[model samples]
Target: MLSELQKETAKAIVNIFETGSARGDYARVTLLTGDSGHLTYGRAQTTLGSGNLHLLIKAYCATPGAAYARTLKPYLPQLADIDLRLDTDWSFRNVLKEAGGDPVMRDVQDDFFDRVYWTPALASAKRTGLGEALSAAVVYDSVVHGSWIAMRDRTTAKAGAASSAGERRWIGVYLDTRRDWLASHSNALLRKTVYRMDAFKALAASGNWSLDLPMMVRGVRIDPDALCLRPPVNASAIEVATRNLRLTDPKMSGNDVRALEEALSKEGYAINRDGIFDEGLETALKSFQRDFGLVDDGIAGPATRLMLGI
Candidate 1:
């Protein structure tokens, strides 16, 4: 099972790619504020309600004992104590008289924006240019928080008994050979089950789990709408997991084959989509997974699906 963080990371990357399509500019904002510092949306002259630099704090919290824990530290030096007071004007008038323009804020804005616009959605997608780090920051929140889930069916819905007095009939000795369904599982298995508990509850009780957005502005339309994390189906931008050569069968036709070929090529697997996975095709698919440091299983599973970027 993948971590919520991992899924969020993927979702964020996807969103940035999608935003670039609609807005022509998907910015990466690196708040030059402290952990508990307040983040507000204020125009050059207007003011907005304060929002705790909650996203940043959540990022740090997600990674418990990371060496480079605070994501904003590299950008906001001389980090002040976490003060979540909203509506306090950034005294630029006094700031200008005391010291020149804010070097930190300027630096953060320049770097963050540059990164978001420059970084390719895929890991190491750059070819012949400077790379961006903050682009990774835009999707930062989506890939971290827990998503709601629930059980699709109820357990122990039926009980069996003989007049409430269960009796065992004489039977031959029965030897068990099956192993426990969850015995000796990896630690990740347990963590994933625990992580999705909230979603499980929501599904068990209701049917949907919603993400708690960091408050949205009233009566105003925010680009990349604050509500939806996933991209719209009609989004112009498409995700390509990787860039490499791909192959297709001579028998395959038109756009269907074309789309599959492109998707697979992005995953570094080139195969002719001649409506069949022949011997050569199977070998190629397995080799592609191997090259990606994936489980080289012949079957194409979730990881491979992700690689296909669908």
Candidate 2:
């Protein structure tokens, strides 16, 4: 089994490829034209066209203390149906973007991606007798990016099974085959993603089978610090504005809630900036809503969040 750090390094490599960040962009949303995976979102960019986006969002909505659950719950039907119209729905897209900043949403995504992609990738690696961390990373990428089975079969047919041809050699052949397939794919968008394979080829060439840290991927640095889960160093105003804060059974808690409390305190409300949205924060929020002529529901939806400037 790969050590925890090696697994993290492997994941960070793909995270950089997927979202341009080693830690992954929890709030990143991409909709590339001619892309088979429509309306990609969160860490690994689960695709709406593949119905995984629905699964990711559904998982988030079910989690308690999810800041945007109420706002996002309404769109579950459209997501489940794989409604392509959602590709252009700016409102839904904005909500998804904002939800990315929520800690609950981030946790849900880590778990969901691991369950849906990482676990299977590891199993595939073990079955092929491929124990190298880099090998696992390549398989994980194919699983997340799609068509692993077809490409794995093609590579086996061309170069023989990894068990017989040897793991490293088989992986090299697999990468070459996958690179060719991506370059010649009918989907123009997919053709552009051959860079992923190119990056892997470079890594294999360097003999970095262990996925050592301090690696550079697509111009992003994947260092020890970059792999740690933390808030973005410089968050955009829109990301901050999109967080839907509210009280929950366990009490929503995060920097977003702390920002809301600080804003309320600035406006002459007595509240603590402890990052926990408890009853005290809710009561203060209700008072602020009443004073601002908004609904006094205490749920910090867009209106309340906007009013508080959080």
Candidate 3:
């Protein structure tokens, strides 16, 4: 059984990657060809590849006992042999999103994640004698970013042996090694995402090895005791009138501009609703994107719109 702290920590960190605190399964496409010659997609991040969705579909069909499993059974075979090589095909992507993003299916997916990923981490943590909360947080984050074995390998290489060092020292070594991996990776995306390591480093630096105290991950303060399942106010309803908005389009003035201002203001960015997409708005938008782990391109394109849940 997963502890409350473990579950909450996992949810909080995943929220940073999935929707940037915008709760609800917002499906986004991330295409990659795996070593097994299969294309991976959706929110598996880099670890499970496209196999994540494939596994989810399989698990759902196998467990007809689940109240919601039967509803998704008929659609199983069609998705059973998904070839993500053609991930761009609307039929494929739509079906994938519907199944993967269904709110009812989340509990099923969570169970899958816990079984496949979190449980193993707990076992490893127990062997290392790590505190429950800290171990879960470290291992859960690693599963999303890559794999626990890789993390363990690095920890072993850096800190000599887990038996030789204290829990705090071992965690510090693991985090430092993770930072190095993220920084020197061949993939540009991996290298650029070192901020995750920085967040872990912050926890270590504060000596919060137990992770029971208040913590901050990626500029967002997390109060574990007062943690609410709901996201920040209006996170799901983040939308702006972009019918005629663009960079440096002299006519940045419109209802769209006013709408954007209101949205940004709700996010705590003070802006005059003067119907102009001025430098101020652009700066605030970039800041928001940074906080949410979105690309800081300062352009409100489809990706940005999706991140804002528009």
Per-model lDDT: 0.28, 0.78, 0.54
TM-score of each: 0.23, 0.72, 0.59
Q: Report the CA-based lDDT of candidate 1 relative to the real structure.
A: 0.28
Across residues 1-310, which tens digit of lDDT does each residue of candidate 3 receive? 4567656665566555443441324354344322221333333322122234545555666654554455556644434334444445566556556656665456666665555445555655666656646656776666544545666777887787666777777877887887787678555556655676676777767766566535666545566333334322111101111232344746467776777777778778877779888888888888876875544646553334433433
Best lDDT among the predictions, by candidate number = 2
**Top TM-score model:** 2
- Give the residue spans of candidate 1 off by over 4 A: 1-130, 139-258, 262-270, 299-310
Which tens-of-lDDT digit does each residue in 167-249 have in candidate 1?
11000000000011112223223222221222222222332122222221121122345344332211111111111122333
Supply the TM-score for candidate 1.
0.23
Per-residue lDDT of 1-310 in model 2, one digit per residue for the tens?
8998888888887787777788888998887766666678888887777666876887899999999999999998887667889999999999999999899998999888876678767876787778999999998888777777678889999999888999999999999999898888777667777888888999999999888877877777687566433322111111011334667677789877888888999999998778899999999999988887655767665335534543
Pairwise TM-score winner, candidates 1 and 2: 2
Q: In candidate 1, what residue range of length 10 has the lowest lDDT sum?
A: 169-178
Ranking by TM-score: 2, 3, 1
lDDT of 3 at 174: 83
| lDDT of residue 116 for candidate 3 | 48
